[model samples]
Target: MAWYHTYFKGLPQRAWKLNQDEEYTDYEVDFLRDVLEITPDSKVLDVLAGYGRHAVPLATDGTALTCIDISQEYCEELQTTAGRGQLPIEVVCADVLNYALPAGQFDAAYCFGNSFSFFPRTEMQQFISQIASALKPGAHAAIHTENLAESILPNFQARNWMPVQDDIIYLAENEYRAEGGYIEAEQTFISGSEKVTHHVRQHIYTLGELTYMFEQAGLLVVGTFSNLEADPFQLGDEQLYLVARKQ
Candidate 1:
């Protein structure tokens, strides 16, 4: 199994449950609506839509959504939620890189939750290209992730810990491979009496490098934000929210 499969498998349902909170869900939906300029009739594609965090709410509000994820468990859970709520969501369990999306099918698309850099450089390029191919001309794509600038910060820490929920604490240790231009992360999740660890490797890219890749894929960079609320991007911002339009 892939490292991500092992990692996501170990996470309990409660870990996914936290993202379903109304406050966070509302903010995510609003971000998509305002930033991506989505409407109730828009057809949206959500890449790596774990547990339907954004899918369910958007579908509930009458937007059409197609979600793809590698985890069958997450897909099943999302399907159940959508069924119960009678939301218009189609969940597909497949690796995003290998999945075949209908050409020019989506009006808008997004990949959230720091999911962008999981693949190596070449594969990441292809992944972006695939998204671009799936979008209608002039359609928008939003990517939310931790900025590479944070990894290169002078004050960067190799290890950190934070509580994601009342009972769940996440511990992360990182190593930067300057030669390879990637960062390797080992994450441990502790909840109650259970503990699980997952390893992730991500390619690090400067804003210019990312822009080049997106442009090569025919996705034109239009805006960059620090977060979902559209805060102006800065040099040292921890998170990057990039918006692009298909050419």
Candidate 2:
């Protein structure tokens, strides 16, 4: 499997089916809209648009939408969601880095819900460039992600579990290592048939580091907010939403 696919390939997608309507709060939506300045007729590219959480609602504004994800399941699900609402949208199943996105086609693009920080610095820059290449000149993009300095809930550490049908779902402890740039977790799923354990890993990017990556990709920063509410960013905002335009 490609590195990008490794992120969610082992996830219990079966459980995810239960969270279809697990909607984001209005606070989140307004923040995205303000950051992206989303507008009607904007040709939008939703990268790693898992489960259409953010894309579906944006499409309601009558924007042309294209959703891409590393998981085929998600791509299919996004398309199905669009179809159910008679929304015109395109779904692509491919790694964001390797996908041959049409140059200068999108009016804007977005990578929400911490998707931008999944890759290391080297890989992250490529992700930004991929977005730049896919967008028309001056096209805007918004990225929503955890702020390494703000999101480490160190005070909260412990294991939690709940029974789900035949499975005992457990969320293991979280570790923020490598100067808060690397995160890891242990997940155990116990079912009557078998026990499955997943060790997940992700790279976290600081705001300074992310800004450098965006600049390297020739994207100019126009806005930065702490969350989806257009709140001014602070030292520990938990979330960072950045808006930039392709140069």
Candidate 3:
């Protein structure tokens, strides 16, 4: 089984949650709304929307959100949260590559939280194609990742540690495999007396490579930004946000 199959269950989930804050999420939501031209009547898809961080807010604003995530723990939490707030969110717990997306059903779609780097080339192409198929013609899609070649290669670190919370620390020991075009990492989350560790891998794709993949998927690469501020993507940027439109 893949590491991600069980990665998000225990301490990783807690660490991930701690890594994000309401202010940052709000900023990202605003950027998504503007970039996707979202409206109350729009139907949106949140690919791998763990815990409904973006879905809940967008749905609360009246955009219907269909969220798909593989983690049952996350799906249940999202379902309960949506139920409590009466948000228009549909949580689907399944691997995204296996899901049969409704053709032309969504006005916009997004894979945020650096989750876009999860798949290798072939599977990633299929993933993008599925999102394209689910989008109406001219509909847009956004993908965010920290594993973009230009963003990561220039600042690659062998090992790093960051505080997730006052008591929790997240450590990563990474190895880059140029032949495989992937980074394998041993990720550990330490909190108080408990420590949880997992091995994970993320594929690295350059801008040109990703653009070509988008083209092959019947989507046109429109813009690439380094941040939510809509700044053009450049080398040394910490993250990448790419927007494409269905052809």
Best by TM-score: 3
TM-score of 2: 0.83
Instruction: Select the stronger candidate by lDDT from 1 and 2.
Output: 1
How should the candidates be ordered by lDDT, best one leading?
3, 1, 2
List model 2 lDDT by residue over 1-247, tens digit each.
Answer: 4334654543355544443334563456555666666677788899988777777877887877898888877788888889999886888888877788899999888887666656777878888998998899888998877635555553335466666644545456667776747767676665566666667666866677777888899998887787555677777677777889889
Q: Over the stretch 70-89, how does candidate 3's per-residue lDDT look in tens digits?
A: 99999999999999999999
The numbered model that scores best in lDDT is 3
- Badly placed stretches (over 4 Å) of model 2 are 1-11, 14-27, 153-168, 189-195
Candidate 2: residue 55 Cα off by (Å): 1.6
Could you tell me every candidate's TM-score relative to the true structure?
A: 0.92, 0.83, 0.98
Off by over 4 Å in 1: 16-21, 150-152
lDDT per residue (tens digit) for residues 1-247 in model 1: 5566545664544565663467866797788888788889999999989988877778888999999998888888899999998899999999888889999999999998777777777888999999999999999999987746553555567999877768888788999888888878898888888988777776788888888999999999999888766877778888888999999
How many collisions per candidate? 0, 1, 0
For model 1, state the Cα shift of residue 174 in Å: 1.4
